[model samples]
Target: MPPQRATLLQVAQRAGVSRSTASFVLTGRHKDMRISEDARQRVLRAAQELDYRPNLMARSLRTKVTKTVALVSDTIASEAYAGRVIQGSLAAAVAHGHLLFIGETEGDPVVEEKLISDFLDRQVDGFLYASMFTRNIRLPKLLHGQKVVLLNCLTRGAHPAVVPDELTAGLDAARTLLDAGHRAGIYLVGHTRDQVFASRERLAGIKEGLGDAGVRLAGTIDCNWWPDSAYDAVCRALDDGLTPQALICLNDRVALGAYQALREAGLRIPDDVSVISFDDSDLAAWLRPQLTSIALPHYELGWRAIETLLGQPGEPAVQRLPMPVRRRASIGRPPAE
Candidate 1:
């Protein structure tokens, strides 16, 4: 048989004190209980000597706080690119003296409900409802009336959420091109369906930013937000005599496609045509000219969502974190007409 574990009774006996006195000392309630310093020292020494370990389950029975939180998401944990989000949440949870349990639902409602029920059964202190991409989400009914914070997503109205400032990033993209003397012949390369949150907000900001300069986009090259689609659309546009002075792609992938099309047409990046995009992914830097893009702040979003949920009490409101710009060599002065 394994060695017997030391208990509070054993510790009390070794410390030459009553069970209540040893309990008060171990729980740090000695001063409140008017426990003697000498007794406290003796109890601590006895606990050390016996290698006593408090049972967390037993302590939680008295405290009601299990000192743990759960992070439930739809495919965030599996995405290699989203690893930083989990890292950020883990760091914040640990700093607050709590353990973190992660679960991925893969957008399945039944699985999501089961996962959430399991967390609730364990009595996790709080919840982080996250999404891989920013959008409006329908929170599971099980989460109602519980402590929760939305990560990279939001609900219908006012709620606690941590999302990137995509609108401001769009505005900055416009300003970046305009500041480089791009007066006209600017084209936006991406699908601009208003049903999508990021697309609409980004387009609105881009319009507002360019309108402030009293300029407007020459046109939009409608295409799916991907490399091959972007490449085909841009190539066809160029073949049809579309001489765009600059292209503001929706994301880094679209930017890569635009780069390929521009190069194939013998139009050097930032020489004959300038370029800018968003997401600031690793692909942005690996490009030939290195695309100038706005960052998504993935890690910060995860960290701040946990903080909002577990930190000091605050009014429930949406928190839109800033998306900083990562300037590179993709943009420059407009070419001579």
Candidate 2:
């Protein structure tokens, strides 16, 4: 009961050209085939009028290239900030004339296996293995030797990767406060864990940057990376008469907690204690005095990974995109002591 789809023969008949000519024109081989420009245009126009579309399935069977890519992620689609990552991937895929299919595995190995198997069965041209956060990830064994690009994550193996330069961002964070005349009473407002890639790299950059200036963090508040944990820790620190001139939080969420704690203790931001943080999320700008923080290049990570995968052939390389500093009202000169 369904109507038949328009055929290439119909387009060729309408354009008054041979089927081979029509095929060449539609498949972007007109120049190689030495077809006339007029004939190519006529075939294109006829295809448009008749709604004739080449069957990708048949073409892929012949070419052995699907011209499609799959993006497999662990809970990446669930986060709001990471939407830009998907956007970047989609844009680059479209630019390369490839279709992008996305699948979320929710960090479940069984689900991940099934999702990847399904994509493989469908003969996807390539894969983008992405993570919601930047960290070390063991790529799926199934993905080995396949055309793949790692997004926002890295591995020991040499698979092309694109991640935010968190280390540089950390160095910038420290320098931001130092440039504002903060030499002492500077405390870190989040716990640093070696297992976490961002934590270790950012902390190392901060240390190196501060050390370069012949200074160091006065103390650490040691709190979880969440607002509530940071709130309690900062509140305790303040109650114990910890008078920090400036606080460098590990993330925007931690900075939010520090802000609440500072306000409750009759301390004004950048007036009594300047504050700076990382991860320039939506919450960063929404703060009372917009928080000065380093931005995570979520969109660029996705875009660059896809480009690395599908762009000019090259050796597998890890690409760490720069994380820009988003300056705002939160940073100021340390209060006159």
lDDT of 2 by residue, 1-337 (tens): 8678899999999999999999989988999999988998999999999888789899999999999999999989878978989999999999999999999999999999999999999899899999997889999999998999999889999888888888898899989988999988889989899999899999999998899999999999999999999999999999998999999999999999999999999999888999989889999999989999999888888888888888997744888789899999988888884
lDDT of 1 by residue, 201-255 (tens): 8999999999999999999999999999999999999999999999999999999
* Deviation of model 2 at 315, angstroms: 6.6
TM-score of each: 0.94, 0.97
Identify the runs in model 1 with alpha carbons over 4 angstroms from their true place: 1-4
Q: What is the Cα-based lDDT of residue 50 in candidate 1?
A: 98
Q: Which TM-score value belongs to model 2?
A: 0.97
